[model samples]
Target: MWGVRSGSLVRRRQLARTLRELRVHAGLTIEAAAPLLDFSPSKLSRIENAHQGVDVHVVRSMLDPFDVGGDRWSEILELTREASAKGWWRAYGLDDRGYIPLEAEASTIRDFTVTYVPGLLQTTDYIRALFDASFRRRSEATRERDVTVRKIRQERLTSAERPLELLAVIEEAVLHRPVGGPAVMRAQLARLVEAAALDTVTVQVLPTDVGAHAGIDGAFTVLSFEGLGEPDMGYVEHPMGSTHVEKEEDVTQARLVFDHLRTVAYSPAESVSVIERVAAQM
Candidate 1:
């Protein structure tokens, strides 16, 4: 797990959760607390939301309003510093890869795809083909960088230490898409079978006959952390943009939907058989 050791993303979220709890425990809301510290409510709210990290001195000032000090105060300040640290993904300068940073830190991923193969299970050829099909052309350097990023992300699945556990349920239509042509699709499907054989990975296929199933809304990934303090996250991407779902209620609903999808999808072994049969046909 990327977060099992150093984790800026998880730490930032953890800090935000703690500060929000502390403010509420002190009987103050963002609007009320901001005035006491001469801060705009939005600024303080952003800090509590982990959108921005405050300097240690600013944190001290913020904590004073809540009458917090001693060890607890020091702990939060340490967390703030940790949260402000750069994540491993930043070294690659992946500004366009919106979800990789979070995905890297996640201990587990529960993905349900209605139209495409999950990134973690895609073959190199399949990856390049998807990029080639993009409406906007990418330079060779940019394309290869993305390919490298995907390969690196896949390492977590087979790591000697604490590999990431993946549970994926995909629509049967995904197998028929022939994303990169017959050869590429065959290799991609074969890769799925290979990955599913791992103890950390489980793949299931939702049959075409399961009409109007639970995941009709589209694809979404629910990422779970080590549960030390960080909450699970729900990520959804669309053509226009992507957003992270952080609310406890919404994330819980995502989990519930995923659970239902798993139930209606083929069993792991049966799913592998389905994938093999499809690849054979290809």
Candidate 2:
């Protein structure tokens, strides 16, 4: 459920969060630090809270107050610049609104889905059918646009530099669903089997026989970036909206839930057999 991708992740708060940590470590309060940086209290506050973007020059200046230099200094400044950079999706008129940017930037994704197939693993026909099945209506062009976005995202799975590591756990029901009728679902399931064979992808099935498990709370994802000094992010999507969970406790809990689900789910080989068995029945 890329449900609502237009959440707070557009600026990705790592830069702000890091700055606040540095300021606190420096033993300076917003009031005390504002003058040192030549920023109004509100401006500094906004930057620290991620309400506003800070310039690289301003961020460089901030190092003096915190006595940060060398490697750590370079890291903070790089993070600052990353905060304001535009995503490639922007060129396709998709930007600053949703989980696409974050997904694009993530090096690994732990995806658990209760409804439909995980977007990255969907076949074009399945994607078309899923979009068409939506209760909300849209032009063919918009549906086509979404399909394109999904395809582009899938490219990361085979990228040379850093292929995305995808650990996707889908409820067994996903394989059985007649997403685009029998043919489409069959192809999609076949694709799942093929993808699971890759070194970079792992596909697991949470069988109904598990009865109850940690993932009873619906679907969520845990995304890990390669290295930006940021913690893993937890995302949950529902009908009305979606949420970005960054608090350490919440993300940790999501991780635990996912771990439990993985423990209970079928092994990769068994999962492939399960998909094949299900497809045969259809």
Candidate 3:
């Protein structure tokens, strides 16, 4: 458990969902509840947005002021307690405060890589080099833990039930990069060729000769979930951190960009040929 558990995030989201339902049932706008709670509208908004955790006392004070029924208050209090419980990821001394919970729930992943292999598909040497290079400033122990977490995350690719559907478009340069030297690069490319054969995995290459592409902006991921429908999310990672974009406008933009990139990328068979050629050169 190196990150927040999926259950905790779902529980927290549920609190907001529940409150919204209650507000709709009561025929009141969020604005009306602000004056009644003696709190700022923004405070209520933050709580409902799942951006802030509500303490037990605070929950009691706020809901009591609203004259919500005793049974309803009890139910909400239980939900709040569930939401506040420490997630399993805490046990591993890793902060899942944001990233883990969201990734754990994604059912389909579409990503474009400009500089390196995507985490889920990376070989051990590539991953080791990636972590070593990434955490150049961290202690050895911290870096090992971080790398181990990434391996655990990759389990989703092989999971029997509800295996993730992954569609990755990687730049040709990624296959040529010798992260851990020539041997590692060859083995990694071989693995990529094999992995591409898997039913759930689709690998495409955007060749350098293609000249221009939509993914020139940088790497991005689109995570889709079952039951959530078409509300795709976009994630952009930087050297220090990653951010999730949930706004419809941003998601739409990411989708359009991905579609364009895919169109320019090599077909699965051609991508395999490119990887095989790279491996043979090594």
Highest-lDDT candidate: 1
lDDT of each: 0.86, 0.85, 0.77
Report the number of clashing residue pairs per model. 0, 5, 0
User: lDDT at 250 for candidate 1?
Assistant: 95
Model 3 CA deviation exceeding 4 Å by range: 1-11, 31-43, 54-88
Residue-level lDDT of model 1, residues 1-282, one tens digit each, is: 354443455666688888889899999989999999898999989988878767677877888888899999888888777666666666667642378867766889999998889999999999999889987678999898888889889998998775899999999999999998999999999899999999999999999999997789999999998864678999998887898898999999999999999999999999999999999999
Candidate 2 Cα deviation (angstroms), residue 238 = 1.4
Models sorted by TM-score, best on top:
2, 1, 3
Q: Higher-lDDT candidate among 1 and 3?
A: 1
State TM-scores per candidate.
0.82, 0.87, 0.80
Q: Please report, as a residue range, the 10-residue window in candidate 1 with the lowest summed lDDT.
A: 1-10
**Tens digit of lDDT per residue, candidate 2, span 3-45?**
2222235345777888999999999999999999999999999
C-alpha-based local distance difference test score of model 3: 0.77
Q: Give the lDDT ranking, best first.
A: 1, 2, 3
- Candidate 3 has its poorest 10 consecutive residues by lDDT at 1-10
